[model samples]
Target: MNLAGRKVLVLGLGDTGLSMAKWLARRGASVRVADTRTGPPRLAELKRSLPSVPANSGPFRDEMFADIDLVAVSPGVPLAEPSVRRALDADIEVVGDIELFAQALPERHARIIAVTGTNGKSTVTSLAGAMARAAGVDCEVAGNIGPAVLDALMRREDAGRAAGLWVLEVSSFQLETTASLAADAATVLNVTEDHLDRYRSIDDYARAKARVFSGDGIQVLNRDDPRSLAMALPGRKTSTFGLDAPRHAEDWGLLERGGEPWLAQGANALLAVREMKLAGLHNAANALAALALCRALGLPLQPLLAALREFKGLPHRVELIGEADGVRWYDDSKGTNVGSTVAALVGLARLDSKLVLIAGGDGKGQDFSPLKEAVARSAREMVLIGRDALLIEAAVAGAGVPIRRAASMDQAVALAAQAARPGDAVLLSPACASFDMFRDYRHRGEVFRLAVERVIDAPKH
Candidate 1:
């Protein structure tokens, strides 16, 4: 907690790293910034933020670890880097910004709602914060979803702090370097295969996410996911969220009445499932997780449910972009892993409509096998793109669906339009990262929208 006179290295100059470097330097920690990428995108911003702090532009140097007391790693920097390992060997404690934020919290403390999972972390985190704001609670939503956790911590310190809530969207990457993060309530929405490039195995990835429950407070778990349910530790009060009826007094789930489902806590029906604007049963799980987190922190349910009804959902996740030739097109650029895309395919499946799926990008060393079953059930055809297109094709080969390949997003959209029928949905739910053909996922989604617009606005033949 005592940063003064400590020598710290801020690894990777992404937004989190820059914020951490600035914070540490301001607090008198001897800070140095380093990135593997030569001239990282944020290099200029980093220099402006902490001009006095020395920085390295290329690969990490082992020599830097010699004098460092602690290394604050940005979430994007993999812990497996040789320099990080060298730091560990040198007995230099390595931690992320979240850990630093935890160490900086006031002694009396504010309620912490830590949300994590492969998918819906952002939606649930945002939803929880909206719920708190709707209930008139002073809340800060940060961590991976907004400003860095350390930035949020500094802002709270600058203000005349009051007892409220801090809702955090914690990713596995952040969780890997975090310790001492004892939340008032924590939940891993659901754990599925993701970030296989950085992790040794799927279990390792899940283990990092499960650490969100390390605190002595309540653990909110996804009852439907075996991986998430397996993280419930002994001696911790646990609550659950899922599609089935609640099985315990404190559980949040769904109930069927008059052939329609309602969100319920135990036997009490809170709101009809139709009342929520979020699409898919997966989103229902996210809503339940947010509701459970709020109830765990003693927030009013009515206000939370009200916020849920009004929440329009985040962009790039099952977002409807345009309609053309009687086909509905959806953009799910955030579906960067197999689990997320699988969930989307099933969640958006309609009995009266077939799906023409556009997928493939950087596979990130993940197995596309899980996506096979869902694609077989819902997708009428698969239009592939990016580096791992053939890999996905091989995995979904036995599904009896026709597969096509496109050289670019525009071509993919055109192929999808050609294949789509009147009731068919054209979905760009790439089950891989966007780094292959685009700058990032947002760029991928933007390009998809532009391509769809071109298709829609073209002359009708």
Candidate 2:
């Protein structure tokens, strides 16, 4: 792990790359950065932040790989890319920010709880941190969700807290480069088909997620997902979370008492499901996963349940925007994969009401067939947008539901509003990445909200 006098190349100048470059430079490694994109908006800031490290912001050159001792790739950059392949062929080590941070944390100041999945990772990570803070513990939440892990480690170090906890939302891409991340507790909430462009197949993608269980740590698994259970390490102490009743002593699940559902650990009821602020079955599973992590880390059950009851849900993941003319509007723009969208569609589906669903974007090489049943059961009408609109439409073809296409978010909202009736829900839960139509998922969510507001504010005839 010694970087002194080594020539290292940090590829892609996003958050991970920037943090890694600065960290490596501080450790006296001769660092250089390269990105295919020419002069990103924050390129000047990246240069200012890592003044000692030279950068190549344009196309990557083969000469850049020459004599490089190591290559640190950002998650956004595909590992199978030519530059990374060249590094491999040259026998130069290629790692990621997560690997660097993991190597640096052998005697870590903070206890770590790392969560990874195709969806709900951010929600679970935030909830775990909130629960810890509620119990009066010093906690920091970072990694894939926001601030870089190395920076988070630095922040924890600066505070010098004796018992700080780090709740990190790790991604499969990040896990690909990490080998020695020994978390105090870790969980892969659920793994489904995703990142097909970066991975060779679904099994390959799931294998990347399974890395979270590599270290000797308490593993929290999802009993409902076969892929999650398949990834469990042999002989590790494991706890599980699922919608069904818990069959094991350490598992978490829902139990019915007095005709009401309660979040339970084995047979013991921790909190009534009615008290939770988060809506839908998917969120209930997220809460269970978070609670399992809390238990593994020995956080107080009472405080964690209290935090779960009061915690407002994260934005853009089944977030309720508003209601107008008796129709509810929801923004689930973070449903950037098939599994996520199916969760939203099925979890929010009601026998008494209908859903006007707005979906479609970059398919990311995912098969959309899984969404058919959920869409058919809930959607009164489907409004499509973005690059893979036709692909999604064809996947759910002939469900007896009316389908329409929109040129823009504004038009989509108008059409959805027109199609929606009283007691219906207008949901924007595109099961694909937002890069096709917008800057990112957050941007897509914001635009949807603005469109809804415009429709809400317009005078009704």
lDDT of 1 by residue, 113-176 (tens): 9999999999999999999999989999999997888777777677868548899999999998
Candidate 1, residue 34: lDDT? 84
Tens-digit lDDT track of model 2 for 51-76: 76788878888999877898999988
TM-scores for all candidates?
Answer: 0.96, 0.96
Per-residue error at 150 for model 1, in Å?
1.3
* Model 2 stretches astray by more than 4 angstroms: 158-163, 350-352
Residue-level lDDT for 351 in candidate 2: 25
> RMSDs, each prediction?
1.6, 1.6
Q: On a 0 to 100 scale, what is the lDDT of residue 435 in model 2?
A: 97
